[model samples]
Target: MQRRLIASVLLGHYLSAFTALGIPLYLPRILADLAPDAPLWSIGVLFVLPTLCTALAAPLWGRLADRHGCRLSLLRAHLGLCAGFLLAGFSPNLALFVLALVIQGTFGGAMAASNAYLATQLDKDGLARALNWTQYSARLAMISGPILLGLLTAQGLGLELYRWLAPLPLLAFALVLPLPADRPRRPARAAGSATTNIRLPGDLQRLLAVQFLFSFAMVVTFPYFVPYGEGLGIANDALLGLLYSLPHGVYLLALPWAQRRAANPLGVGLALLALGNALQFAIVQPEPLLALRLLSGAGMLLAFVGLHRCLSQRSRQGGAGRLFGWYDASGKWAGTVAGVSAGLLSQGYGIASPFLVACVAACAALLLARPLVACPRELPA
Candidate 1:
């Protein structure tokens, strides 16, 4: 029954992500159609707006879930996402569209809510495993979302598909209805089971910091990645799409192995990420760039697995809804800042400049993560 619930959550996560992921990619085009005279920076602002709002709103939602139930929170996210997408689809002007995005970000925190819901059903190790599966579902969505969207776009359905994606999350909502409700567990039960007795505030702060830096570094390079690739001389759309999906592919293939084998996955992952980003800035040739991209992907797998392990352990102590809420907020805030910074850096310096910034952030994250591994209670070998 637990496995079935996990499977349902994974499926819901993938479907929602697969349908909604294309919006960011298609934003510029969507903006062009809606407001041809809009400034370039507005596109960036709009792109980041939802994330910014989500960061601000997630904690409140988390508290709500803690007070109510995670199952209810999960249902709310799916319905909220559906409403937000519908609003965006029907908006007649830019102002209304911006409002739609605000609604979307403010209420569409399904990932965090889902993680919190899962925390109710699993132990530390089992929660870690479930988180991995959730990440895999997201990675799979990233791999397939664009391809499917591209096919539909090519079919002359065009922008209408954006509106149509609004209903996908409802399928996820229905899936959640049959799952058992989340009941609160006693603190003693969690304390008795946990392998580590983590001290709060300090440990939690470090985790939040790691999450922030990890997100900032990864997302900082995303906005202008296509332009950077084009600068490297890859012109074919199909090939470019393949190259773009490489890191996600690497995650799909390598994360499970990394989770099992790496003794200090977070430390090693941060090191690889720093190296990959730094080297990427120096290398101009397509082949070497591809290699570095693969290296970065490897780093992503280890780093994400390590982080999820820590998160799972922490979430076990009850009030998981609130904990995961803050956790997701940190990452969302990082993404919001990263998106804005990428646009600025790309415009002022060059498309490749953000890679250097990402490298610096990764190095900072590496330094920050050292203490985490050194503290035996925080992470498993």
Candidate 2:
């Protein structure tokens, strides 16, 4: 029964991620098809607006998950996503498309709700394992979504196919109905209660800071990787696609190893993140750049899984949903900032300069992470 529940949750995560991310992967193509004369800045705005809305909405969804139930929250989120994607599929203009994204962001709490549910169902070790597996599923979706889009586009059915597939996540959420119902376990404290006003642990605050910095660093170079690669003289569309997916491939491969033997996982992950970004400076060729990206992917997966595990364990007292919500929001906010920064750095400095900024941010996150890992918090049994 537990295995089945886990499987269902994993499936839900994969489908949600696939649908949410897949369309955006084709944003450039979608815009070109819908509004051929749209400026490049429109792409950035399209991405940022949804993310901003999501960042704002995450906390409210988290609180609802905590007050109501994880299962219900997941259902609501998935349903909203289904409707949002359907609207986006039929959108006649960029304004309507942006509205669809806002709807998706406002109600799509699949990732946060899933994490909260798993945190409740499993012990610390089991939670870590589940989180890693879910991360793997998400990474797989990231890799496969783009490929699926490419194949469909090749058949000249890209936009139409995306519209048709928009509600696929709704089918995935149907599987969630068979899983055990998640009732709210934590009763709300009365207003002005001592516990209600209590602050987050200092270590948790530092951990969130690390999350923000790492997210910013990762996004700083993410939107420009293809352009940077092109600047490095790799012009083949297929090769560029391969380069784009290589990090996720490396992350999938490295997950098991990191899960098994990552004793100082947070510290080690941070160090690897810093190292990977630093290595980008020396890679002037495509071959070496590929290797650098792979290494960076491994580092990213390790750090993210490790930190999420740490946060889950620490917040297990009943605020898991809220904590994970904040976690998601911080990353989204950082990504928003990073997107703008990446553009400015790319424009003013050079295409590759954002990587230098990313390297610095990674290093800063490493420093912030050290104190938290040194004094690890204990989880309740």
**What tens-digit string does per-residue lDDT give for candidate 1 at 47-164?**
7888888899998988778767888899898888888888888888889999989988898888898898998778888888888888898889877887777777667554466588
TM-score of every model versus the real structure? 0.91, 0.93
- TM match of model 2 to true structure: 0.93
Best candidate (score: lDDT): 1
RMSD of 2: 2.3
lDDT, candidate 2, at 258: 77
Segments of candidate 1 deviating more than 4 angstroms? 184-202, 376-381
Q: What's the true lDDT of residue 214 in model 2?
A: 88
What is the C-alpha local distance difference test score of each model?
0.82, 0.78
